[model samples]
Target: MPALDLPFSLLDRSRTRAGEPDAVAVRATVERAHRAEGLGYSRFWVAEHHAVPGIASGSPAVLAAAVAARTHRIRVGSGGVMLPNHVPLVVAEQFAVLESLYPGRIDLGLGRSLGFSAPVREALRTARTDPEKFLRDVAEVRAYLQGRGPVTARPAVAQAPPMFVLASGAGLTLAARAGLPVVVGGPVLRGPAPLAPYRAAFDDGPAAPAHPYVIVSANVMVAATRGAAEELLLPDAWAMAASRATGAYPPLEEAAAVRRRSLTPKQRESVEQFYDQAIYGSPDEVVAELADLVRRTGADEVMLTTSTYDRDELARADAAIARLFTA
Candidate 1:
């Protein structure tokens, strides 16, 4: 088999299982990173989700520190840290510290999302929803990282870690104006039309890249058979569907349990929609689909955000993806 020409990476949300403690999920994320480094994956990223029972990685910087310490080569970073929930200087300092310790292995992927619910947003003390403010904050964070801010961020390094925007909707424009690379997924992946404007509007700032870069993220799974791969996606799909219907993102449950639950039509539709957005199949099938996705989006990299209840199966899936490129 031919190798996938571009780099591929992993993003672990540290998803908790039904009976497991949150710590287990966090540790699993670190372990997954270790395995990913050995498997020849390009980067390993963690996410931030506050007060969510299903995701244990509320502090991406802290978790990234841990992952960085455990691995020697693979790039480690947040996929990303929510900008609305943080101060620009603080965000700069945290990543600066990570870069100080790990050198070139750190990344800072930022997003404008608030907490999952109103109360969580209240707890975070972030009510700002203005897109312009988010753009300014992103610029401020970049300024600090690049040593151009009025007040210098501490522990300043020779070079700042690279930054990326977790883009959606108007986020493409924000990233273009800010001149940062983008990690895009979800509805935007249905077609390639949205990326054209971003490329056209891209600004080549001092800290920005000369050209627009896109990383296509998705829930991808590979197994011995198509049915088996789909089964692995059930837990995450069910969790997403349940979260939408009940307003609570629960820990991942077994596929058999998900199969046993009788769902309302709306919930069933939600589950199907989740499946529709994902790419999962046997090895050959997945390679063809991912190649098609790269062709459509012109992505510089592919980031897998796959999660499942069984840790071993998840590991196997990661190995399978790695083999696709290495073989």
Candidate 2:
């Protein structure tokens, strides 16, 4: 397959597998980052998911520090740290410390998502999802990171790490007004219509880039055959379906195990819907589809968040996908 013209990255949520400790999943994420650096991926991002059973990464800043320590060249950051669950000053300080340690290799991707469930939200001290509050928090975090906030964030560095907004509807407007780049996926990637306004409305202020930038996030998998690639996606798809049906996201099971279990009509439909949104195929097919996606969306980068029960298979898929971006 021909190399993709633009950069590509990986976003690992430190997905846990059945019968494994959460520590193992965290370690796997670090190891994957080390491999990602060697494979020539532009960046390796971790995610934040509070009180989620399937995802072991509750703190992206902590995970990003671990990843940065292990990897030499790959950019390390959050795919995002949800702003609603954090204090702006504290969030800025945490990422400032990371940037101080990692220097030019750190990134801070911010999002507006709250915790997964009501209990989780309460545990996070996040009562409601406020878009305006999120916008203010994002700005405050950026200000602190840039040394422009009222009080200085300690261990301050000469430069702030680049921030990307994980955006959607109001998020696009917020990012545009803030003049920050955006990372969008799901329905936003279905067509170019959603992004056109964002591009048109971009501020491009002194704190922002000269132009609008977009990073497209997607669940991508690759293998020797289309069937094998599709199989790798089943674990996550099944977990998502179960989560939708039962409200508890369980650790990923082996694809074979997932296939053997029977599902209710709603659960089955959920699984199929998950599959419909993901891109899984042989290398050539994935390259073509991703190329088409990039062409349509005008994405500056593609962030893959593919997860499977088998660590070995996931590593191989990562290497194969990396080859499509590297020479």
lDDT top scorer: 1
What would the per-residue lDDT of candidate 2 be over residues 276-321, giving only the tens digit for each residue? 7888898899999899889888889999998999999999999988
Per-model TM-score on C-alpha atoms = 0.98, 0.97
Rate residue 178 of model 1 by lDDT: 91
Q: Model 1, residue 241: displacement in angstroms? A: 0.2
Q: Which candidate is the best by TM-score?
A: 1
Report how far off residue 112 is in candidate 1 (Å).
Answer: 0.4
lDDT of each: 0.91, 0.89
Quote the positional error of residue 252 for candidate 2 in Å: 0.3
lDDT of 2 at 136: 84
Predicted candidate 1 versus true structure: per-residue lDDT over 1-50, tens digit per residue: 56688899999999999988899999999999999999999999999999
